[model samples]
Target: MTTFYSHLKRSALIILMLNSFCAFLQKAHEITYVVGCFENGTTETLLEFDSDEVFYVDFEKGEVEYTGPYMPGFDPSQLFQDLQIYKNALRNSKACKAIVAYGTIMEKQPSEEKDPPESILYTAEEVDKGVENSLICFVNHFYPPLIKVTWTKNGQPVSEGVSLSRYYPNQDQTFHQFSTLTFTPTETDIYSCTVEHMALDRPQTRIWEPDFHHQHFELDVFCSVGLILGLLGIVAGTFLIVKTL
Candidate 1:
């Protein structure tokens, strides 16, 4: 999540710039690369690449190490030329130019941001056959106070009974939001709530099934029956003891 970086012509600056560039390339575009340093039997990789081919050179052995899928026919040397063009274009871009004109090596420091909300979907009340039920999509502990929540039923978008709550601040300085969808859930009904936010790379979804509610209901009934039977047995034992005494 580290973003903006300044280059001071020092080791710290070099590490900062390289890490920021790697994050920008991976997140803004799908391009990926990693830079590692090995010194005194200690190796540290500043950035990690996920799901990409890696070609590494061993300075001591004068060989290469590869771990994942690779295309042997692809000439990776072209990437150098492409990188030069990309560098020039970025330097010429308005944002980059503005940052340079500010007499700084980089723009403002990146934000210390929070992640997207934890979302859960559940029924507000006991679900009954042939009765309308309200499904609550509780989204909590997110930052920035901006999010989009949507509901779907049986793989189709639902809107009629949907409602959204205003973002509220939490004790930890984060934000929370809620969404509700009311519908008459049947045995085959499947409901889901999806939340989208700037902090998330993809939308978070939570699904609710009618069978889940039924399963919980059955568990509750079984526990209640056991408790009632235990109470009856205790009462009969007490009465018999008192009568015999």
Candidate 2:
């Protein structure tokens, strides 16, 4: 899990490909090696290996420091040497230049050409009165991760007991995210989830009522009883026909 988290974090940080033109002309190429520290499940880039200056994030003090970048199981010298080799290669290779050009082209691509997101609002289980419930609004198949989810109860905005999850990547280069609203439902309370994105001209709203769940439960029970009576009638008719034969 730690390895996976580190890979994901590095993937997010390594968005900009370091392809410096005129590497010899500049004192340092645009290459930054980051060494992130993880404790429990939280991780942050604590060490930044730069050619000019090195720094780390001091989350506890709420400030970043440049005094000394050090970690227990890391050697900055080897990292610097490896980066230097790559920077030297970047100076020589025509393929590297082509890659840099391609990356530039991709960066300038228009957002309008990308597909919009699809969102669905639902709950983990049936919402019942006086029971703790989790109302989830799922937004998926989105190209960009810009989205807003709001929950409302009785036509009023609800902010408490709400949490938004991180953006999870999909296989097709899209993203998925979820927002949860935890509350104890009541008989007359009406809940709604609204989603706002660039794809929609107006906010998309989905409403939920506790009474509907109760109605569905009652309908299911009624259907089950009707099915049982029909089966009994069929059995009795078959027995009577056998006796007559």
Candidate 3:
């Protein structure tokens, strides 16, 4: 599967090819080739196998980076040379621009295949006041692979200690992403995660707050029940000893 993206035009071109040998062997494998061309004459190329990145072209460094081990009988040097040839051909060709133009036109003609993302915001660990913890915002089942996720603390936008994961493909061909925020848990503080995507009419936000009172109440009830059960056991043992004697 090859996917090309033109960020300047906000469109994608996908090409799928299957290897007969792999199919005959009953092994399901996938190859992903990505070419990202920008308006500033900068290009990005990546090759992945089985969803794991194998190598990428570092245009800035003018080198090919081998991120992972290659498949059997595959030579990294040969692959690098082949990529150079492909890159040179693409640089002098207008086919990418033409495909992006066609994709843009197709994008305008919307169909009925939009899936809105479902999101949840929660703490990574049990809430403890003044203790550092992580908040996770998971968004899944979204289409088109474009989304914006933001975090806020007490109604103010939070920037520090935030990280986002790369888009992961789901079985249904939709995508899922995760955003994380790190902060100290405070009883009076509140947090929210907001998600924006084209499939939704408006942005969705999920809020989270620490409820120490409720937690304490449940703990108290559990302890009280345990104490009562222990007392009952002790009383029953004493009565049995006395009757036996």
* Best model per lDDT: 3
Candidate 3 residue pairs in clash (backbone atoms < 3 Å): none
Model 3 CA deviation exceeding 4 Å by range: 1-102, 105-113
lDDT of 1 by residue, 1-245 (tens): 44333332211111211222334645742333332221122221211234243443333443334443445775454434344433333333334334333433343453335557898888899877668989999999886556899888899998998999644444354567889888887888888999998779899999998775767889999999999999999999999999999
| Clash totals for all candidate models | 0, 0, 0
Cα lDDT tens digits for candidate 3, 3-106: 32233333332322221223437777776655544323445556667767677666566666777765789876676665464465355335555655666576
Poorest 10 consecutive residues of model 2 by lDDT? 1-10
Using TM-score, rank the candidates from best to worst.
Answer: 3, 2, 1
TM-score of each: 0.47, 0.50, 0.66
> Whole-model lDDT, candidate 3?
0.72
At residue 63, candidate 1 shows an lDDT of 36
What would the per-residue lDDT of candidate 2 be over residues 1-245, giving only the tens digit for each residue? 01212122222211212223235655654434332222122223322234333444444554444534566876555554444433333332333344434444555642342346677777787766688989888888864456788999999999999999755445354567899999887888888989887667788888877776667889899999999999999999999999999
lDDT of all predictions, in order shown? 0.59, 0.59, 0.72
